[model samples]
Target: MIKFENVYKEYGNGVRALLNINLEIPEGDFVFLVGSSGAGKSSMIKLLIREEEVTRGRILIDDIDITKISKYSVPKLRRNISVVFQDFRLLPKKTVFENISYALEIVGASRKEINRKVDRALELVNLQDKKKAHLDELSGGESQRVAIARAIVNKPPILACDEPTGNLDENTAREIMHSLLKINDAGTTVIMATHAVNIVNELKKHVVTLKDGAIVSNIEKGGYYCELD
Candidate 1:
């Protein structure tokens, strides 16, 4: 489970990124964080990933407080949360298989384990055939799928995606969403920050909308905020 209790995040420039934000996401839940740019969507993602520290309040993942963990311990906290970004940051020199394997290698996984996990992750994203393809060789959607495979190679309990489909077209974005949904179905909690209103309304899962650093709405099976109200 994920919980935020009276969380406040303020920057050195005196900008308040989040204020008194409280939320909870149960295990295996797929949640969408929807809002305009600077609505604190990115701030929430950063806090959960331990990339930024909160000014006040607490964040708990699986009943453990993440706010109190030290910088060195931040890496250990990341084992439970894997992040995917909008840019699909795959290494340019590596093939799909090697790209995914590199993530495991950093954590000191042996060759046998890396191979097995990479194969499974590639299959999950339906990119097993592209295992030998270079990053530059794949299309935008395919590249994002490779990024997804890399993120999930470690089998983390939570997948945090930030504007994953921002660069894809309608059809390709749909494909990426399907890949994410498949991972969520296999019991990984997903917290996605997206502006793809069509996809959000279509999926009709839980949505937590942020406006001016505070939660404006949280709806179960909700449609886009603009269309709903």
Candidate 2:
């Protein structure tokens, strides 16, 4: 559902963050992006989300050329994709239900539809009981789940997560990963960027490794082979 052909991204001061990145993620597939710090994982995501413009080459999502999508149409393009981040990024003052519902509201979903979707999403993440809770009241894992629920509330065709389990304990991380897998099973294309090698190795999913802003390896049913001390 996503493809990048010879993609290159350079910041305003000519710092190249990605180079010749060619990738294809089929619909409903779950893939892991593995890399150390400053290896262009974030850069790839920024390009995908249109947070930064590509310096060269093309990006296609479900056959639509995203690189050429007008600024006015970018919102429409983004409506089909959802992103979760390491920090959760929840509004501090909003309740769990409000946080998830806010996304639908921004998209102009009706009250009844927003309520239904928010509840369904919270259920998916096993957070229905905490719907009225504020972000500060939840544990780190619970907060992360709330972020995931918010991301999927719209039922986006694709989901990209950047280090979703980065800050949690191993067990909690596993739970978060399980939640992501459930989402993947339901047919959303899932791409996760993480440095957690154990999870990637155990899952035996497709893995793309990046180093120095370039793809060092792309393996189907791959393991984490980067040497560690």
Candidate 3:
């Protein structure tokens, strides 16, 4: 559902973040993006989210050219995709229900529809009991689940997560991965950018490894080939 054709990204002051990165992700496929720091993984995510413009080439999502999408229409494009961050970007003052409800509110959903979606999303994440809890009252994993609920409340066709397990312990991270896997199984195309080698190795999923702004490897059912320790 996503294709990058000779995509390149360069920051100001002549620093190139991505170089001719060509890749394709089919619909309902789960993929992992692996790279060291500054290897362009974050840049790729930014490009997909339209937080950064491609310096050259094109990006197509479901055959629509995102690179040429007008600023006024970017919001429409983003409505089809959802993103989860390493840091649970929840509003500190909002309860879990309110946090997820805010997403539907922005898209002009009716109050009844918003209530239904928010409840269903919370149930999917196993956080229905925590719906009334504030962000400060949640554990790390619970907070992340809330974030996931918010992301999927709209039922976006594609989901991208950046270092989602960065701050959790192994068991907690695995719990998070299980939730992501469940989402994938339900047919949401998932692209996760993570450094947790153990989870990547255990999942045995499609892995695209990058180095110095270029793809070094793209393997189906891959492991952590990099020697970090």
Candidates in order have lDDT scores of: 0.92, 0.90, 0.89
Q: Write the per-residue lDDT of candidate 3 for residues 1-229, one digit (tens) a residue.
A: 8999999999889998999999999999989999788888889988998988999999999899999999998898778888999998999999989999999998799999999999888877888899889888999999998999899999999999999899999998988888888888888999998899999999899998888888888898898768532
In model 1, the worst 10-residue window by lDDT is: 220-229
Model 2, 20-53: lDDT tens digits are 9999999999989888888898889888989789
lDDT of 1 by residue, 1-229 (tens): 9999999999999999998999989999999999888989999999998999999999999889999988999988888899999999889999999889998999899999999999999888899899999888899999999999999999999999999999899999999999999999999999999999999989999999998899989987786686322
Q: Candidate 3 regions off by >4 Å? A: none
The number of the candidate with the highest TM-score is 1
TM-score of each: 0.97, 0.96, 0.96
> Where is model 2 more than 4 Å wrong at Cα?
none
Model 1, C-alpha of 68: deviation from truth (Å): 0.2
**Model 3 residue 121 lDDT score:** 88
- What TM-score does candidate 3 get on C-alpha atoms? 0.96
